[model samples]
Target chain A: MQDNYQQKILGIIGGGQLGRMVIQSAINYNIDIHILDPDENAPCRHICHDFSHGKLTDYDTVYAFGKGCDVITIEIENVNTEALEQLAKEGKKVFPQPEIIRLIQDKREQKQFYKENNIPTADFILTDSKADVLANADFLPAVNKLGKEGYDGRGVQVLKSEEDLDKAFEAPGLLEKLIDFDKEIAVIVSRNEHGELVAFPPVECAFHPTANLVEFLFAPAQISDEIGEEAIKVAKDVIIKLDMIGILAVEMFVTKSGEILVNEIAPRPHNSGHHTIEANFTSQFEQHLRAVMGMPLGNTGLRMPAAMVNLLGEDGFTGDAVVEGMDEAMKEKGIFIHLYGKKITKPFRKMGHVTILEENVEALKAKALKVKDSIKIKA
Target chain B: MQDNYQQKILGIIGGGQLGRMVIQSAINYNIDIHILDPDENAPCRHICHDFSHGKLTDYDTVYAFGKGCDVITIEIENVNTEALEQLAKEGKKVFPQPEIIRLIQDKREQKQFYKENNIPTADFILTDSKADVLANADFLPAVNKLGKEGYDGRGVQVLKSEEDLDKAFEAPGLLEKLIDFDKEIAVIVSRNEHGELVAFPPVECAFHPTANLVEFLFAPAQISDEIGEEAIKVAKDVIIKLDMIGILAVEMFVTKSGEILVNEIAPRPHNSGHHTIEANFTSQFEQHLRAVMGMPLGNTGLRMPAAMVNLLGEDGFTGDAVVEGMDEAMKEKGIFIHLYGKKITKPFRKMGHVTILEENVEALKAKALKVKDSIKIKA
Candidate 1:
C-alpha cells in the first residue's frame, strides 16, 4: 500500500502462525506492516497492511520486499540471510540482525559461536557423515541432529546404539551426548534496540513422551524460585550476546542437581511463552511488538497462575481436523482455547492449544490435561 | 479444502475487527470457522479455516458462503437474512436466527419488537423515510436514525430543531426523543443455542464529544451496585426476549433519576465491552467463542480496574495512518494498545484503541485520558 507519506512500515518475512501472531503485536503498536511469504493464504496475510506472496529464501524476492519497509524481521529462521545482510548494509533495520542470523542458521557455526562465547551447551562433535560419529563407537549414545529445520522432534534421532546411525537420513549433522535432566525449562526474554532487556518468569515445559511436542507448560516453573531465576539469567545472557532486538526463547535442560544448560535458541516468540496470552500482565505477543518497535518493554509479571496444554492432532485421524470433547472441556472453568485455524490436521500436527488460568495452579494443571486428552483432532 | 467432515462449521459474515475478534472466540471451542466479507484482506482472513470474499447483502454470495457451514452467525447485522432464512429451512443453524435478525435490522421493526415484548426503550417514532420523519415536526429534540448499516455512532443523528431536522441527512430514519441521561452504560451477555444466559457487569462509556465515537469505557459502571444489578436484569430480559444465541451487547442510557432505558442492540461483540480484553476474567472474545461452540462460559470476574480508549483517525489525516505518542505512552506503565491494521485513515475512522489496567481506578482514569489525548492518528 503506497502512500505519498512515509510511514515506518515493518516488513516481516514468513507469514505462518508466528507471523500472524507477530503482526498482531505490530498492529497493537500501530506499526505499518508489509509481509512476504510464499503462501497466498499465509496466516498473517489479512492482518498486514500490505502482503506479497514470494519466496523468503529467494534473494531478489526478499530484497525487493525488504526494501519497501523501514525494518525487516522474521517469524522463521530459514530465510535468505544474504539478502537480509545486503539490506542491513543499505541501512534497513534487519533484526536478529543479519549477522546474528548468519551465526544461528547453520548448526556447525552456531555450535562454534556457543563455544567461542563461553555459552553452556551439550558437548557435540560436528561431522561430515553419520559414519564418522558411528566409527567413534563410544559416542554412539549421543543424539544425532541436523540443526537446520529441526523442530517438534523432526531432524533429530537418538543414537542409542551404533546401528541407529546406519539408518540416518543425513550426513552432516551434530552428535551430542544426550544429557539426563530432571526437567526441561525455557525462558523467553526481550531486548530492545536501546539495549534495555526484560525477561518473563521461566516456564517449565513437559514434552509428550512420544511426540516430543510440548504437551503442557507452566509459568514461574514449578521448581525452586532460584532455578527459575537462573534460567532467566541464562536467557538474558544469550539475548545480550546476540544483541537481539526482539524476543528470544532459550530452551534449556535442568540437571538433576539443578544446573542449567542451554539446549537451543529460537529468535522469535517461542511456543514456551504461549501461556502469556492469558496469564501475564503484558503478553509475550504484545511484548515482542514493544521490543522490535523500540517502545518500552511491558511488565512481564504473571497476572494469574496458568497452565497451557497443547491441542495436537489425535493419532490416526488425518483427513480433516475435529476436536471432540471440546463440549465437555469448555465446561471446565477458566480455560482459554487458541486454535490455529488449520483446516487439516495430520497425526500429531499442531492444531491449537488450550490455556487454563486460575489462582490455583495445581487445580488448573489437572483440568488442563483433561482438556488436552478430551479434545481430539480427528476426522 | 473439501473433505467428508460431519462436524459443524459456523459461518460468520463480516470480517471487520469485530469479526476478527469473534474468530478468536470460535477458535477457543475448537469450532470450525468460515468468514464472508467483501474485502479479501479483512482482519480475520488468515485466522478462519476458509474465507469467501463477497458483499454480505448479496443473496448468491451469502447463500453460497453459507452452503457448507453447518450453522451461520453474523458478526455484523448488515447481511442477507432472507438467504440465511432459506438456508435455515434446509436445516442450517443460524444463531439469533434469521427471524431475530430481520426484526432487528430495521429501526421501525426493532422498536416494534421492544414494545411488543415490553422491553423499555427511548420514546421513538419510526419514519417511512426522510420525508416521513420531517413531516412530523411535532417531535423536536429527537434522535434521528436510519435503521440499518449504522454502526459506531453512524446511522443516528440528533434532531433538536427545524434547522437540525432540515440539515440532517435525509433517508429512511427514526425520530426518537432525546433523554436527560446521567451516564451511558452497556451490558454484554452471552447465550447458548439452549437459551442459557450470562451477563457481564454493565460498563460505563464516555463518548468523544465531536465524533460521537466511544472515547472511553469503564466496567462495573459508576452506578450504585443496586442499579448495576438492575442493569444486568434489564439486559437479561432483552436477551431472553430476543432469544439471542452467541454474544449480544445491549447498550443503554442511565437517566437523571436513575432510570435505565435500552439504547440499541449489537448481536456480536461491542466496542463498549473492549475492557473485557484486559479487565475481565474471560474476555468477551473468549466468551463469544464459548457461547457459539457450546462450551461452558468462563468466570466473568474483573481482574483489575480497567478503561478502554478508542484510537480514532485524526481529522485531515488521509491516505496513510500513523500513531503518535506511543513511545512516550509506553514509558508509562499499565497501558495496552490495540491497533487495527487499516491501510488508510479517514477522519473518525476507528484506527485502534488502548486498554489501561491499573489497580487504582482514579489514578488509572486520569492516566487513561492523558494517554488518549497524547495519541495522534495522522499520516
Candidate 2:
C-alpha cells in the first residue's frame, strides 16, 4: 500500500495557496504532487514536485496535465470538468467526481439540487436575465446571484425593493430569499472511496462588515447541541447524496426561529476549516488527502477550542505586501500565523490567516479579535 | 518587523530531513529559505526557496551561500564554522554563533565546557589517540567517542573491558565514564537574540537495542517533578552559559539516585522533540524558526500526552524503498506519520517517524508501541 501511495502521482488543478498547503501535507507521505495553473508564479510552483503553466479551464491543457497523474484533485472548483470526466473514463481517479463539480459550477443547479434532494434551504426562483428578475417584483427582497462565474463577493446583489432590481444580474442567475438568521456557520465533512465519512465540529463565522468574507471564526459554534448535530447531518447527507469522495464545506444559516437553512457549499478544503491545522487532531488538508487517497479518515476531535482570523489586505494598500504589527501579535501565546507567499497586497485580498487556540471559546474569541486588530497587511 | 522578516532570507547549511522540516515551517511565514547541501537530490531541494548544490564544509561554498542570506543557521552542525565566523564579522546574523558551533562540533570540547561551567555531566578525559585511551587502563567500562565528524550512532564504541579496547577510536577523541541511569530524557530549549528563553517539557527516550538511535519517545517524561524541573534547568543553563541564540537539544541521564547528568547536546532540532509537532502547542520545527528569526518564543505547553516512534529501515534490505503496513497503521486514531522523501532504504536508516497522541501516558505508550511494530520500511 505504501509503495502504491508513493508511486501514485497526485495532480492538483489549481496552484494557489490552498494547493500550496495541500502539497505541504502531501510531502509527509512522500507523494509527488503535480500542479496546473495559469500563473507561472503561483504559490505552489516552487514546492510542488511538478508544475505545468496552463489554463485550468482549457480542455487540452487539463487533459494533458491529467495524463501523467495516477490520481487527480483540485484546490479550486473552476477547472474544466469535461476533461476530468474524460480522464475518469480513461481510468484516472478524479476525486469529488466531475458530475458533482458540474452540478456545483452553477448556482441554479446547486439550489435545484437542494430542493430536489429535500435538503433544507431558502426558497429560490430561477431567472434567465434581469428582465425575468424584474418580472417578479413580489420576490423583491431577494438576493440576485449569478448562476456561473460568481466568486467572492462579486455577481451578487441585494434586491430589497423595485428600485434595487437594477442590480439584478444581466445573465442567467437565481433569486434566493434573503434569510434573516441568528448566525452563519459552516461544517466540513469528508468521505472516502471506501464509504467512510467524518465531520469536523461546526464553527460559527463572523463576516467582515463590508468585505463579504469571513473575518473571525469560532469552533464548536455557540449553537445548541441539536443545531450543531443537524448541521453535521445535513452536511454529510449532501456529500453522500452527491456520492462524492473528498472533503466538502457546507455553509448554513441558523434563522431566528431555530430553522437551519443551507447557504452555500464548497467541494474542497474551505476557509472555515483553517483552524484545524493547529487545533484539531487532523488538519483538513491532511483529511482531504486521505479521503482522496482512499485512506481511513483521521480522528476529527478537537485538541482545544480554536478561533481563526483571516488576514486581509488593508483597504488602501495596493503594492508589495507589508505586514504590520506581526511582532505584537507573536508576543501573544497560542497564536499561529500563516502568510501566503503572495508578494503584493490589494484591498481585501487574503494575504494570510491566524489561528488562536485557548482552553475556552470565550478566550479564543478575545485573543482572535485582538490578533485581527493588531496585524495589518499594507503596501 | 514583518517587513524585515519578509525581506530577510534564511540560509540553512544542510538540505536533509531536518532542513526539509524547517522549510515546511518557514513557508508559513512566507520567508525565503536557501539550502546548501552536497546531495543534489536532498529532501529539501524542492521545497526550499533556493537550493545550492555544494559542499557544506567547503569555506567558499558556505561563504557564498551566506552572502545572499540575511540570517544564516544550520539544520546540521557539521558546517564550516570559519565561513560563518567571517559572515558574522561582515554583519550577517549567524545563529548558534560560529564559536558555539565550533564548541559543539567536537565531543572533547563539549565535555570540557560542561565541567568548566559547573554543569552536571559524566566525567571524561580528552584523548589524542588510541594510546592515550589505553594509558588509562583502569578507566574500563568507559565510552570512547571521536572528537569530530561523529554523528548519530557513529564514531563511538563501548570499552567494557580490555577485550573491547580494540573497538576504541584511534583519532583525537575522549573517553567518558558511562553512567548507570534509570532513564534518559531530553529538553529542547530556545533562546532569541533579545535574551528571551523558553524550554519545552522534557521527554523520555528509549534507544533501539542495537541501532543506538532513539526508538521511541514519550513527552512530559514520566519522571518526578523534581527531576523534570532539574533537567529543564540544566538545559536552560547550558544555552545561557553558551549564550547561543537558537534552539538547542540537551540530552541528559537521570540516575536512579535522582542525580541529573548531561550526556550530550545538539545545536539544532533533534529527533527527541518530534512529538511536539502534534502534541505540543508549538512544534520544535516552528520553535527553531521563531528562535532564529528573533521572534518571541511561542507557548511550549503540552496539549496532551504523546509518544513518537522513529520509522527505521528494516535490516537486510538495500534498494529503492518500500514501506509496508502503513495502511494498517493508518487505521488507528491519533497517528500522524511523517515520511522523509528518501527513495532508497538502507538498514537502520531514519526513514520517518510517527507521533501518537492520547489522553493518558499509558494509552500513548500502548499506541506508540503498536504503531512501531506495525510500520516497516524495506527495499
Candidate 3:
C-alpha cells in the first residue's frame, strides 16, 4: 500500500469563471489549487487554496507561481508561454503544452496550422494591415480578424464588400472567406499523457445577435448519425494532431451543402460544455482535471437531453449585479442556475448560465428559452 | 425585475465534509457561506466565504455567527439549539428547525417522539444507568444507547442477554429491543417552508462488522414496491410531523417478518445518500440548499443504478493518510471518487468514498466490492 502520500498541488494561470469551476471539481480529489490572477477579487479568489494577485503575462510572476506547483494549467490561453516552457523543462506537468498555447494564441497561426495539417477549414489569407486587406478586394465578402489579443467579438469585423473593408483592422490580421453556414456546433475532447482520448457529443450553438456570444446551446446536436460521427472524428483528429494534453473545445460550422468546417478552438473548458455539469456522467471541468492529472478519462456519455442559456448582463447596465426572476425561474423543474460570483455586471458580460434537462428535446429547448427571458442580470 | 438585489448569506454550524460539499453547491448559486467550527483547520475553512473558528455547541459563538447570516443551518445536530431558536425568533431562517434538532439530539427523546407520533419502531424501554438496565432482565436481547453526545457507533451496545447488561451506559439512556432485520434501508426527505415535500428512493445499507457505520450503500433498495412506498411515506410523514424545513435522513430496519421500523434519524446530509451526487438528477447537497433557501425542489429521479463504498482508514494505520490503488480504482469506468480533505488518518475514520454506476445491479455490486477491496488508505 502507498504510505505517507503527499497530495499534488495544481497551479492555474487565470482565476476567472473557468478557474472557479475547475476548482469546484478539484476539491473532490483533495487537490490543493493555487490561482494567479490580476484581479484581487477574481471569481476563484475566495475558493482556491491560495490566490496570488499578479498578471498572467508577467514572466517572473508566472515562473514564480509555477515553481510552487507540481502540475501547471490554465483557465485562459492569454498567458506567458515562455515561463510555462521553462517550467515544463524543469519537469512540472504543463498541460495543453506551452507550444500549443503559443500556436493558438495567434489566430493567423491557428489558421495556417489548420491549412498545413490538411484540416478542413474556410480559405483565408494573412494580412499585415487594413491596406493589405483592401488590396485583397478580389477576396471580397470576407471576414477580417486580428491576429492576436482578440476575445469574444472584439478585434473582428465582416468585410461583406469593398465598402465594408474600411472597418478592417489596421494591425496584422487575416481575411477569410465568410461561408453561409446552416448551423454552428462545438465538440469538446480530452487527451491524457497515456494517449487516452475521449470526446463528448457535439452541441449546437446559437449566437446572440448583438453580443456575438453563444446565447443557447443544445446537447446531442440536431444532426444525422453520420454528421455526428464525423464531428467526433474531426475533434479527435485535431487533438491528436496538436499532440496536446488537456481539454480542447473545437467549434465547427455546418454549411447548407452538408460540409463541416473548423471555426475556432479553445484549450480549456469552454462555454459550449457547461451543460455537461448536470446532463452528462462526466462534466467538462472534471474531465479537464482528469486529463491534466493523467487520470483515466471519465465516461463522457450524456445522461439527459439538455439546453444551456447564457445569463449575460443586460444592455446599459453596469454596476453591482442584481439578479431578477431567480426565484421565479427556479420554480420550474429541471433547471440549474450557476452564477459566477462576479458581484458586478457589465453590458453583455457573461454573468452565469442556466441548464435545463428534459427527456424531450423540444421541452428542453422551450424551457431554456423561457429561462433566458425570465432572468436578467442588471444593476 | 429585481432592483438592487442583495444576495443572502448562509451560515453553517459545522465545517466538515458535509459543509464542504454544501459550499460546493452553494458556490453555484453565488450564495455566500459562513462556517462556524471549533476545528481551526476544518475542511471547509478554505472554501467558505467566511469562517469563524469557534465551538458550534457554544451559545455565544453560534448566535454571533447566525446574527451575521440571513439564513442559518447545521451539518451536525450536536450544536446549541437554544442559539438557533433565538435566531429563528429574530426572523432568521434556521432550517431543520431548532426544536426538531433538539428532539433528535437525544436518543431517548427521539424514541419517545416515534412512540408518541405512532411511528412504527422497534420496542424499547428507557434506562438511566447500568443497574437500571440490569433490573430489566426480562427485556433481554435488546440494545442500549446513551441519551446524548453519542455519535457513530459509540454509546451503543447490543444486549443479547442479561450478561450483556454490564456493557450498558451508566448515564441516562435507553434500551431498545434487538431487531432480526432482513436489511437496513434509509430514505432521505426534504421539506421547504411552503410545506412542499420530496423523498428520494430508499437505499439499502450494509454496515461494517466492527465500525457499525454504513460501509456500502445501494440506491433503489432491493425491496418490494409496497415496502419502498411505505418507507417513503413514513419518511415524509416524519418530516411533516416535525414541521421542519430542510433535509432529513430517516434510517429504518426492514425486519425478516416483512415489517419496517424506524431505527434512527439525522437532520442533515447522511452517509447513506452520498451516492446521489452522481446517481441521481439532484444531489442531496443541492437539494438541501434548495430546501433551506426556499427554492423549488429539484427532480430526485434516479439516473442510473449506483453503489457507494466508504473509504475508511485502515485499521492499523494512523497519521498522515496515504491512498493506495487510487490509480487502479480510477481506471474503472463510471466511478466517481470523493476524498474529504482530511490530512490525517485514524482507524475507521471516514476518509473518502467511491461511487460506482452501472446499468446492471450485479455489475454495480461487483464493481463496488472491487473498489472497496482495491483501495487502501494508510499512514
Candidate 1 — which pairs collide?
B25-B289
DockQ for every model comes to 0.32, 0.68, 0.58
| lDDT, each prediction | 0.79, 0.90, 0.90
Model 2's alpha-carbon lDDT is 0.90
TM-score-superior candidate, 2 or 3: 2
TM-score of chain A of each: 0.94, 0.98, 0.98
Error of 2 at B168 (Å): 1.5
List ranges where model 2 is wrong by over 4 Å: A1-3, B1-3
Best-fitting candidate, measured by DockQ?
A: 2
> DockQ of candidate 2?
0.68
Real contacts recovered, all predictions: 0.44, 0.68, 0.65
lDDT of 2 by residue, B1-379 (tens): 4546878899999998888888888888888899999998889878888899999999999999999999999988899999999999999999989999999999999999999999999889999998999998688789999999998788888888899888888899999997888999999999998889999999999999777899999988989998999999999999999999999999999998999999999989999999888888788998899889888788899888889999999999998989988887776668899999988889999989999888877888888888988899988
Cα error of candidate 2 at position A114, Å: 1.3
User: lDDT tens digits, residues B287-367, model 3?
Assistant: 899898877787788888999999999999999888888877766678888988888999999898999999999999999
Q: Candidate 2's residue-wise lDDT over A75-148, tens digit each? A: 88899999999999999999989999888889899999999999999999999998999998898689999999
Every model: Cα RMSD to truth:
4.6, 1.4, 1.9
